[model samples]
Target: MPESATLPSATTKLEYLRKDLEDLRYYLDEFSAFLPLSVIIVNPQGFILDINQAFENLIGLEKAGVLGSTVAKLFCEQEQFAELEARVLKGEVIKGARATLLLRDRQISRSLYLSPRHDCEKNIIGYFLGIYDISENVKLTEGRNGTVCARTIELEEKSEDLLRSRAALMNILEDVAEEQKKVEQERDKTLAIIKNLADGILIFDPHNVLTLINPQAKEMMQLDESSVVGKMAAALTKVTNIMPLINFLGRNIKKVYRKQLELKSDKVLEISAFPFLTGRETLGKMVILHDITREKAIETMKTEFVSVAAHQLRTPLTTVKWSLHLLLHGNLGAITAEQRDLLMRTDEHNERLIGLVNYLLDVARIEQGRFVLRNKNVDFIKLAETVIAPFLEVSKNKQLNFKFIKPREKVLPVNVDEEKMVLVIENLVDNAVNYTPPHGNVTVSLSFDKAKSEVLFTVKDTGIGIPEDNKQRIFTKFYRAENAAMASTSGSGLGLFITKNIIEGHGGRIWFESIQSKGSTFSFTLPLK
Candidate 1:
């Protein structure tokens, strides 16, 4: 808690004696009567100094009867009342702590603001406590059906007496009251935004009571707004069939929780719950329900189309590849040099087409969530050697320097899908050789990093680097760099996209560094264990 500055001048200060604080307290009490919300003034030690007409009516207590009483004696929840009283007396201000109250044996929900009161001398004295009722739509239900409620707000008070101070308690109260009116206006705007949202919005308190449900949420969940606000979450779950969503909220209160729930054969909901935290108190939780049924359906249809198309294309492509292989190997018959040369070139293009089809099928499987890995421990050193070995021959024909820098520790075995790992590394090496100019360097290397928990595989190339403007879209499907597209080497751009997915599936990360017209280094890390 902190102290406020003392008032430097008050005309009544010199004229009044020590009892003037009592007179000031009386003036403050008079001011509280004008306030609509229930108000109280309490001493430094938690004893009530005064109560306004609204406070008496709201709490069902006579002002005179509870004047010297403590908050614990009046409120059913002693712990919360005591804690709030203690904080205010220590010079802290507590606001918007929308706490559920068990008053007169009936539950009531309200927002609270408690501020420490200081005299003209600035020494800590009493406190001002205010309550705003939000229980207009509140009700109760308990059984297999029940509702809970909660909102948490906390504040740290000005903890020290200030040297440069000059303000009175009256001025502070006026400021707070003015601020409250502005806050209410902003809250109205927020409500309007929530009401018009496409996604369903549901707010619940710690007591499991549904505090709010936007109109969109009500329509989607088939809820009757007239009866929904006060109902318990358990009963709401029965009506909405959102058991998985409710269960997630129950377990992970501290974090923002999200889960997809299939409520029916045709409907799926992406539910996200965010905890409203103020200081150390978790005031409440806000849940958003996004309808993802249509999106899911579209994704399924796309996957099916890709799968069917790839299957149909795969058969004819394989047949052509085999025929070209037989011709190039002379398995059919001997051929002229010019004829053989044309067949070889055709075979290469056919292979590239087949590779593209394979990549499409892999992407389809990935999108359908069917890309499962059958992992095995494999020596990446030998794997790299085998994949990069062929690139050397291609580099030689282009008159370029290509090399593989194997780590000194040698036998670097990693847990991965060997076939997929080969695709990832080979694609990188192929890109390196394809882009580098004649006589330029392309180096492939492997090393252990992050305390040997991961193995890093890198492909370095001194090539026509990616343009600054186009770098961000490089990993996107069907996107090729301008320079690469202009070059003779053809590329599908899915190579890096698929490579990234493969690395991530292995619990690794892929990243790169490049400067236009200079070089690029593509690296991915795979976990050892």
Candidate 2:
């Protein structure tokens, strides 16, 4: 072997080592590119030797510009960075230590993990540092803490509102409970009053179903409350005790007022019906039954007394009338002019007394239900003419303008009692002539309603009209208006009462319309059949 080839020259060994170093640097760059965390290599002097792409992005700087920079210049906390370096040089590994990374325009919070790099001889030469961004995590933790505090405050406020609402609701519930108690008490009191009331009471709903029947009502109707209540008016018609009332009311349940209903021959009741109203709404109906049997019996006795008294005086009055008539006409003996005049006046007085007695007898017969009607078809026009002929002279004497208005179609006939109907016309005509003032008008009209098969007779007179307070008793027995009594002392106050009875007996209706100080109109309707 040649002496120069025995061992490689020193220059040749240097070139070989230089190639190995270049290969090692290439491998380290390749390994750092794959690492996810921001990574940097620091020399023993604390200067940055190299950095990965992740570290360049975190510092917003290029790796070429950051190379050879002091590691402490990249961090805001110099003292902490120095501590981390010293600890790493002493062979202690550091992990998750907080540090702030400096950028060109801003700062970034980061967690630093440092580990010392060693040579083949196990001697520390440099440090490998890994960094993690903690800026977003720190912001999220602070936000979460603040959110917890705000939520606690909101929960407290909601709890306070809930307490206030609970108290208000309790007050409302207490008030409602008290009002309900008062209502129950009032209902109990009302029920007690109705149970013990003398008058009978029945309450019905709008559907006409009986809802409540007081004890008095049950007793008066002779019915059990369980069986009668909750029954419709139509269904109750089958009950014999209440049938008459149901039939009378019919469909006019709200229109009845103080109408007489005879439950039996010995029992009579005055019933009134009214509605339960709330504002303009009709809620239901209420019926009240009041006993009137005793009143009717008393009235019957008084009528009987009047009938007997009138009967006893009738014979004597007839005898006096005949005796006075003979004396006035000179049938007994001749008399002087003065005596004749005196007897004429006496005869006039006797005639009036006889008329009163006849009126009383008619009233008695009417009250006893003995007023029989002999109905016959007769020309009412001719009858009215005959009755009016006698009144023409009397009206003329009073200086009254008397008019008789008759339908164009004559011969209007009606089925009625001839004698009683003649009396009715005479009574009406005589009253008009007597009561009317001089120069006032007395109109008698007769009309026929073919549609209704009835005849209407009207006698209107401009007389002393009835007073407002005295009008209700105008047709009652022995009842005289204040104005009528003041106008004449001779009125018996029984003419209208008799007239009404006679007219009603013939299936007719009579009514009068009068205004005080104005005038009066008396009208009547009679069925033709």
Candidate 3:
């Protein structure tokens, strides 16, 4: 015979199983309702699938209300319920597991019996839960064992004990309920604050599943709460509006601070992420999106203003500088030593102004993405030497001990824009000399790291080092440390900012270490060609 003819198809078998299960449930329910013991049917997960009328009365809860709730919810001793379920699910039948059943307004002592239910294939599918009220049984047993007068006295004592126990249970339950209410209130307040926050907020659990997305976040991401919550981070990439943010964060939602993400041409957000930690455990991560459109607009406006103002002032400053140069050189007319001195000072001041204007123009170009690099292979040691040569006289005049330490071996050339590289080296050497006190030491060193294929340049100064609190903003544009400002009042504060951009543009890194009142070491590295 063919297999199809010999046995029922899978669909037919499924139909037969369903019919058998329905019939079994019907008979069990009818039989259990008539029995004196309370009975309930629970799935393998311990959720109530069916409850008999007797079980409903025993717990003082309606069958409609009790169905779909966990069996443990009806019991005051949840640990005992858990133990009973564990034993029964392991194919061990439980009999008379003592427990307390929580009623509508009181508690009752009960004994529970649980046995696993199996299908035709002997696979455990559910459990049969039976409860017996043991209070009446205890009373009956006490009455059977003693004389009437002695029993009467014992019964009175037992009654007093039962009343005290019930009173204590009621007090404990009331306290728990009051505490729960307080917790609920606090949770509501926290949710209210998060919901009303101007900044968007997204909270993901340790599994990277979206646990909470506040209203602002939903609106900003243009997502529906019903569709987005409970989704994993990877799944969010499918969403058009939020895809850029997800891509920027990548697969790992690490701790990032104040990084700019342009969601659209008109909308810019400063995104930050941090782990939500409790003690030593990381519970989840929270991503905050703060709108920065207005700040970016204002910054653009300031950069444009600086660029225009610098361009307009440069021509006049150059004219004055050339006129003073001619007069000081006697190209225009013969002048006395005193006139020459005044003209030279005027030329010096004019040059300083021109340098400031140039710095402003460079900053504007950097902001506008117009700063370009023209890279070529050149000896880095020679470049460093050329930049440091001009600072030697300045340091000598201040009586500062200056030194340039180069590597003993010939180093490979680095690919960089020579002009900008000169600026980088000049800025570091100048800061070291200008900040050092008279008789203080300033050292500029160069070394090659073959293992990393890079050259390290360091400038160390035994001078008034940067303050600890101000170290974080050392390379910030136009930011001068209080100590540096006190030491020299003549600086544009744009040198380091421009220097950092140049180094980073060459695919290099720059950093510094300093201790207040001790010394400072500024270092940078460039990859060798």
Q: Highest lDDT among the candidates is held by which one? A: 3
Candidate 1, residues 51-97: lDDT per residue as tens digits? 66777777776777776566656555678878887787777878776
- What stretches of model 3 exceed 4 Å from their correct place? 1-171
Our model 2 lands, by Cα RMSD against the true structure, at: 36.5
* Whole-model lDDT, model 2: 0.82
| lDDT (Cα, 0-100) at 202 in candidate 1 | 88
Q: What is the TM-score of each candidate against the true structure?
A: 0.58, 0.66, 0.71
Which candidate, 2 or 3, would have the higher lDDT against the true structure? 3
User: Per-residue lDDT for 461 in model 3?
Assistant: 95
Residue 16 of model 3 has an lDDT of 97
Name the candidate, 2 or 3, with the larger TM-score value: 3
Give the Å shift of residue 380 in candidate 1. 2.0
Tell me the tens digit of each residue's lDDT in model 3 across 1-529: 7766988889999999999867765654455565555667777788887766777777677888887677888888888678788888889877768888788788888887676766545667667776766676577666655565676686667657544533333333333344545766999999899999999999999888888999888877778898878889899888777788889887567789999998775888999999988667788999999988899999999999999999999999999988988897779889999898888888889998998999999999999999999999998888888888888898899999999999999777889999989888888888888788899999999999999999999999998899999999999999999999887547878999999999898889999999987789999998887
lDDT of each: 0.76, 0.82, 0.83
lDDT-wise, the better of 1 and 3 is: 3
